[model samples]
Every structure is written in structure tokens, then in C-alpha cells.
Target: MAFTQQEIKTGFKAIFSNFGFVLLWLGQLTSQLADRIFVYVLMIVVYQSTHSNLGVSLPLLAFGIPSVLVAPWAGVLVDRFNRKGILITADIIRGLLILLIVPIISKSLLWIFLVSLLIYTAAQFFAPAETSSIPELVEKHNLIIANSLFMITWMASSIFGLGLGAPIVNFFAEKKTLAISAFLYFVSAGAIFLIPLKPQEPAKKKTHVLKDFLMGFEFVRRNQVVRYALLKLFVAASAIAALSLLAISYASQILGIGEKNFGYLIIVVGAGMLLGMLTLEKLRHYFKMSSMVIMSFLLSGAVLIGLAHTGDLRVALFLIFLLGVGNIYITSTIQTILQRKIPRPIRGRVFGVQNMLVNSAFTLPVLFFGFLADLGGILFSISILGWLVLLTGFAGIFLPKFRTV
Candidate 1:
């Protein structure tokens, strides 16, 4: 039988009216690709120079800590300033900071790391602005689709960037590679300028910025659902980071692949994430939020555990693929839930707090996992975390709110 005309019309409407979404997705693709490339480039460069996991991991630490420390203030600005302007300014600042490397790469490692630190701090402001701007660009009913598109680009960019980074960095000098990343940031800044919508004006009251920042904390404290959602996200982000910290070891030893293969392995995971995000809307119609959330966690937790048991490279790749899908769905759904639950005026702050949780969740585990990998081997350490993730999900299943959601 032919599909109904109403179904076709609804699909067409969704595509035609979502011009902002198209721009957002394209911008996200380019920016995230550059961002991921920067991460891998830093890691590879540091490892080649210092040959220590700590050296490769230092930039991640540098990036994460400032976001955690400055999130409250960053939240306030995200709310008070024009978010689109914040986004554009952040891109320009970060691009300029990265370009500082072109002339200084040979000076000292400390100088390069400091530039990375500045870029990370800039990211603190950029994240909240970008995340909070999404709901304003699309219809309420399109939140799932919008989130799906965002998640898809996020994973694709990571996989693509990392996959491309190894070859590019191998071919180009370090300074030249950094220059490519800078070019990408300039392109992203240009896109932000083209966004047609304007940011909201600041409130008329001349409130202190610190006091205004505290209001975000107070507002989140009063919202139970947002708090619960953030907690779940914390657990998920931590587990994912723990898993990622072990990937280099896993690639080198378990998979019989070299450093370059880690990038390719991540691409497999990204493929799974893209598939999951694209299908999320359809899945939501069949499963309630509660079911999807629980299943997402369970699947991710299970895959990580299974990844440990497999010695076969193909089996391991499949497990990682499943983990990617599970993680993206869980994380994207949480963001969509926040967009629905929080008021727009405070959305920036809410998301800023959420960003803090994400940074904290991912960062806190790095040292512990790095040490664990040093002591117990990467597989065992990651296996232990996989179990914790599973237990956390099971416990959440019994929460009254978890069931209701």
C-alpha cells in the first residue's frame, strides 16, 4: 500500500522549515571535526615527544579543569550576553589562540601547552552558548530530530577528524597541522556570524554577575528532574571517559593495531553513534523516556563489559560500535529532556551547570583510570568500570523518578 499523504507532508515540512538546523549541523560538523583533530593531534604529538601516557593526557586535563572551575561564571554570561555573539567571540578567540602556535611551536612545550589551556578555557564559554541556543532554533516537537542531528555530527566529526588527523599530522609538520585547525576555527566563526537570529537582551536590572551566577545554582537546586537528569549524565560521562582513556592501550596490545588504528577504531564507534542518533526519533515513539533511558544505559554498560571478554579484534570492534550507539542515545536524550524541562531564560545557566557536570564527570576519572591502566592493564581496569556502569544503571531503574521518566 502507498504511504499516506499526511505522513509524506509531515516529513517534507520537517526538512523544509529547518534551515537553521541545517546551518547548525554544518557548523557543528566542521567545528567538532577541528576540535577532535586538535585532541588527537595533541595526544599524538605529546606521545611522540614525551612517550608517556600522562604527557598525552595532560591536554585533556588542562581542557577539562577550567571548564569545571569557570562554569558558574560562564553560565551567567551565557544567560546575560547574546549567546550567538558569545559563540562567535569564542570561536574567534580560540582560533587566534591556536594561531599563536604557528610562530611559537619550536619555542617550548610549556608555551604550546599554555596555548592549549587557553583554547580549553575558551571552550568553557563556547559550550554553554552552543547548547543553549538549540531550542531557540527549532520547534518544540522537533527537539528529538534536532538532537539526533546534533549527536550525529558530534560523533561523525570525532571519528572523521581523528581518522584524518593521524594521516594529516604524519604528512604535515606540527605547526602546519595546528594551522589547519586554526583555519577550521575561522570557518566556524564565520558561520556563527551568518546565523540570522539574535541573542536575547540582558535583563534591565543591574545585578552583580557573581550574584546572578549563584542564581543558576539556586534554580537547579529547586528543579528535581534537572538534577536527576544531570546525575544520570554524570554517571554516563564518567564511564565513557574511563573507557576512552584505555583505548590507546587496547589498540596497541589487544587489537594488534598501532597508534594510528585507535583513530580508525573510534571511527567504527562513530558510525554506530550516527546510526543511533538518526533513529532516535522513531525509537521514542515506541518506547517511553524511562524505557529508552534504562535500555540505553544497559546496552552501553553491557557492551563495555563484553568488550573486555573478547580477544578477537572483530568482536572487540563490534562491542565498541555498540557502546558508541548506546552512549550517544543516552546522552542526546538527556540533553533533549533538559531543553524540554528548563525555561529559556535560564536555559543557558542550566546547560552551563550541565557542562560543569560533564567536564567533572569525564575529568575526575582520567587520573584514576590512567593509574589503573598502569597497574592492572587496560582491559582489567576498563572491565571493572563496565561493571560499575551496569550497577549504576540497575540502581537507577528502581528510582521512582527513573520509572516515571
Candidate 2:
């Protein structure tokens, strides 16, 4: 049903009417913010101690690899078990695992890496469960705003977490800062506990768990539109991974700003995304979702190349802001399309496959680009990466299957 003007007038008020979804947003936001803080801490610590560009990139690989390996198993659990229980349990596991870092990190860096792997694995389970739970918490008509709000939580939290991460680390240092990171996970669990949600049972099945696990992968491949959405998201995700790996170096080496100043870049991007999302909601009905996706992909590619080439901080900031604007359109729309198109029975697995595709896309590129930046310098490495994104955008136009998006 098309939204009434009153429904539009309600805007956020309509979303807030669904209290369960609000709790879910709260849980996801804190957990995501905690994730950023953890990354920032690792970034600062590794950069300071080892002073290696690749060293700063290593934590990203550690974060993404676990999610890739465990995503299928996690998706199966999300579909088979109670998602609320899975979310809560994952939070507890990650919270406790992060605390262990405070002790062992002083002894060895291996411990820090290991803890990051374990905590991310726990999050892998939480990710699909949360994505799959959206239909249960909010009505179908509200999915766009619901997904947009979720994306906002993502950028907004990162803005604050990354913006504050350096100062917080400089203030409390690593050990105490990690202690606080653990506490945020507890807060997430508490918020999730307050969410009065029940898991939806898929159509009755006597199928084997392995068969069920494999089905999510097969499901995505069979659907043309969903597959196209995933391919585009994968491309965008890879570019983001490359950007994240290079941001510190981009600031420090190319722009002649200090490394810590990267946070300002993140904050600007977040602000741009916030504006993009707001614009999207207002104009959602003005364009077809498929057309919008294609346009945004092309837009992202153009600006990413711009950001890569610019050395002036002011120009770089504008380009990153435009990237942020384009990114929200792709993310929010792709997620909303996935939610609307995928059947709830298999939503967990679809999202599981999605998590694997994006992060797997995220993992290898971050490492490759880090090595590339070291060898070729940040300017050449990023310029190549941006052109790659632009190429992906071109692919969407020529590929007839993408026309179906």
C-alpha cells in the first residue's frame, strides 16, 4: 500500500510506534558502535606499536574472516532456533571474550587477534538473526523506513564511535578502553532482552540440518533479482572495505594530515549519509527501486574516483561526503528490497549468504589494497580501486539480468 500523506507526516513517529523494532535498533546500534570502538582501538594500538599499514589492516581481516567462515552455520541457527535467544547469547559471548583481551593483549598480540576472531564469530550469528527478524518486528509497508532507520543507526553510531575513538583511546589507553567496550555489549544484550519478540517458525520441515544449511546458498543463486542485488552490494562492499583500509593512510600520507584526523573524514561521511537517507524517504515513491539502485551505484563510482584522486582536504571531504550520500541509497534500498522480496521462511539464510558475500568481498580486498598501498603508494592504489568500482557500475548497465533489478 502506498503511504498516506499522514503516514508520511508521521515519519519517524510511525516507526517508533513499533516498539519491538525500536528495541532491535537499539541493540544493533550499541553492538555496531561497540564494533567500531573495538576496531579503532586495534587500529591505534597496532599502528602505534608496529607502525605497519598492513598491521592496521590485519584486524579487519580478522573481523571479516570469522563472519565468512561461520555465516552458513550461523544462518542455519538463525532459522532453526529462536533469534532472540541467539542474539542474546551472541552478545554475552562477545562481551566476555572482549574482556579476555585486557589480560592477554599485554602478554602477546596473538591474543588480541584471537579474541577479535572469536568476538566477530559471535557477531556473525547475531547479524543474520537481526536481519531476518525485521519482518516479525515491523509491518511490510513500513520496511523502507525501518531499513533506512537501521542504516542510519549504522552510520550515526560509527560517526560518534570513530569520531571519539581516538580521544577515548588517548585518554583511557587500551586496557581500560577495552573494558568499556565489553560493557557496551552488555548494554546491547540488556536492550535486546527488553525486546518482546518471538521467532517465526518456517514451514514445517523434517529436512536434515545440513540440507537446511545448504539451502540458503542455493536460494540466492536461483533468484535473478536477489542475485543481482547481492552482486551490486558486493561491489559496493568491496569498495567500502578498500576505503576503510586506506582512510588512515589516505589522511596521513596523501592529504598531509595526521593519521588520527581520519575520524573527521568519517564524521563527514556519516553526516552525508544522514542527509541521503532523509532525502530517500521523502522521494522513495518518485522512482523505481531498481532504477534508483543503478543510478546510485554509478554515482558512488564517480565520487569514489574523485576522493581517490584529490589531495586537498576540502576536496577530499566533499568527495567522501558524496560517497556517503550514494552509499546510503545503495545500502538502504538493497536491504529493503531483500526484505520485501525474500520469503521470511528463508530470510535468515538469504541474509546469511549476503553477510558472507559482502564480508568475503570485504576481507580479501582490504588486505590486497593494504599491500597495494604499500607498494604503489596510497594515490595509485586508491585510484585503481575507485576505477574498479566505476567498472562495476558499468557492469550493472550492460548486464541484462541487472536490468531486472
Candidate 3:
């Protein structure tokens, strides 16, 4: 099952040399960077205006709600139409929506929420189309490297996007930052335009959307690998979402730094993710996918527990850094598994379901933990999350289906 060094070397070389993949990667880089900054900016604005963790969570809820409602239909469309068109159109619409936010920035939170809702609704279509496109653009054997490269840039953008958010807002002001994010979305659309993807053939027989969506769920139910991978993905997604909400409180209350400086902690987490991705790239041949995932769960839980008690800035940074490493390992491994295991024709539908689950994962954690942090304090809530993660990892060891992964 181990890949040869020559095979690995060739895979990496082939990824960069493939023009379609390069364009896709570039599109992903810009779009994801814009997304991170957009969310950070929204959180900052909402937090400052209302000064409540619950206020901050409201916008996050807006972001997640669309994924629940739109992703399934978006996935069906992806299978039935040209994905490149969907991707390009989504970018344009999202860009426009972001621009629309500028005029009403000073008006009302409800307007901002409405704009946020529309922006993420467009994003729902973009996400599955973008993921499914990777397999089409790259050779089957090179998928490992392709996904690795994508995950690497994903974190790199997070590092720069979140790291730059405070200064970007302070210097350019919120309106200008929104303008810059809109511009990046347009740049992403332009990159996708240059990619030479063949048109997806229409389904020979028109299928009902509800039927197709159900079929996707059926497939996941029957396929143990996909089911298990998705469960792991959900856990990882929830952990990250909850952490993002709590990081503001952790920075202000625990570390005694101002809430505006929360991005510094995120920057540290992103650095750790980048380091983890590089290490995973180097050592992938040495570990089983299941082993990597289980280990990551345990590592993430331990880090969270450590972070829960620490008040020293350096120690908290180090622990959160490890949390980032564990998060990346879980995500990257599960994503590669899904790409390899799912059938090509049904990839869009399944990934759409995945988007739903991941976003739904965001909804509960953000709301519950936002309230929990306010009531029980940040450390207590974080400790509860840490224990939950730890127990999940321990349970995985005895689950026959998971062990088989």
C-alpha cells in the first residue's frame, strides 16, 4: 500500500505541470482567502457593534444556514450542468453580493445578515463544484499531491487572511476591505475562466432532485469508508467552528489580550496547520489513513484540554498550534479518502451532502458554545469540548468499521 519515492516525486511534479489543476488551485487560493477575510471582518464588525458572543454567532449562523438549504440542490445541478459555469457564476454573484454590502454597512445588522445570507448561498454552489472539479482536472494517481497542495494553500490563505484582517480593516476601513474581498472573488472567477474544462454531459434521463439527493445519502449509508470519513470530518469541522467562536473570548478573557488581537491566535493556528501539511506530505507513505485520523483526534483533544487551563500567552499559543496541526491532519486525510472512494458520476451529490453536514456541524457548535462560554466561562466550555473529542478518538479504536479504514 506504500507509494514509492519515485511515484511521490512524479505526482508532485505532475500537479504543478497540469494547467487545469494550476488554474483550479489559483482559483481556490483567491476564493478561500477572500472567504476567510470576509468572515473575520463580519465577526469583528458584529462583535464591536453589539459586544456579545451571541451577536457574533448570529452572522456565523447566517453563513451556515445556506449550506443546509442550498447545498443539496447545488450538488444536483453540478451533476447535470457544466461545473465550470456554476463555479464562474457563483463567484460573480458572490462578488456582487459582497459589493452590495458596502452601501449598507452603516445601516442595520439585519441588512448585513441578509447580504451574508446571499453571499454564502452562492458559496454553497461554489464549494461542491470546486471540490468535484479537482478530480476532473488532475490525473487519478496524482490526487494525493493535488489535494495536499490545495490543503496547503487553504491554510496559507487562512494564515494571511486572518492575520491581515485587523490591519486590513484598520488601514483600509471596513468598506474598503469589503471592496478588496469582492475584487479577489472576481480574480478567482477570472482564474476559473481560463481553465479548459470540458462541459459535463447532461444526464441521459432527467432525475428528480429529491431522488438524486436521497440516492447520495443511500450511498453514504452503505459505504462504510465514506460514512466513517464523513463522521470524522464532522467532528473536525465542529471542533474548528467552536474554536473560532471561542477564540475571541479566549484572547480577551484568558490571555488578557484585547479581542481585536484574536487574529494573532488564529495566525498561530494557521502556522501549525501549514507545518502539519508539510509534515504529512513528507510522511504520508509511513502511516495508514485510519491511524493518522485517530491520532489526530487524540492530539486535538489533548491540545484543547491543555489550552483550557493555560493563561500564559506562550503556552496557549503552543497548544492552539498543536490543535491546528491535528485539525489539518484530520481534514486532509478524510478529503483524500472521499475523493478516492466515491464514484466520479456521483461525486458532486456526495460532496454536496458533505457540505451540508459540515455546515450543519457549524450551526449547533457555534450557538451552543457561544451561549456556554457566556454562562460557564471559556475554559469550562473548551474543557467539555476537549473531553468529547478525546472520547470520540477512544471509541474509534473499538469500532470495527472505522478500524477497517
The clash count for each model shown is 1, 0, 0
lDDT of 2 by residue, 1-405 (tens): 356778766766877887888889989988888888888877767766666667777788888898789987888867778889999999989889989887876676777888888888898889878877887888787776686677667778976788677677778888888888889899999999999897677757567878887888888878988998888888888887888778888888888878876777888888888889779976678988877787888888788778777789898888888888888888878887887889967776677788888888658888888888888888778888878777776776798788667
C-alpha RMSD of each candidate structure in angstroms: 3.6, 2.6, 2.3
Task: Pick out the ten consecutive residues of candidate 3 with the lowest summed lDDT.
Answer: 396-405
Instruction: Flag regions of model 2 displaced more than 4 Å.
Output: 8-21, 132-147, 198-204, 282-287
Tens digits of per-residue lDDT for model 3, 1-405: 347789889898888899989998989999988888888888888887887777788778888899888888888877777899999999999899989988888778899998899999999888778877898899888886787677678768967798778778878988899999999999999999999999877778987878998988998999988998888788788888888888877898889988878988888888888888779866677888888888889899999999998999999998988988998888888887888899977777788888898888668888988888888888988998898888778867888777655
- Candidate 1 per-residue C-alpha lDDT over 20-111 given as tens digits, one digit per residue, 9 for 90 to 100: 65666666777777787777777666666765555556667767788789876887777777888888888888889888866866666788
In model 3, state the lDDT of residue 45. 82
- Residue 86 error, candidate 3, Å: 1.7
Model 1 spans with C-alpha error above 4 angstroms: 1-25, 82-84, 102-108, 131-148, 196-200, 398-405
lDDT score, candidate 1? 0.75
lDDT of 3 at 162: 80
Arranged by lDDT, best first: 3, 2, 1
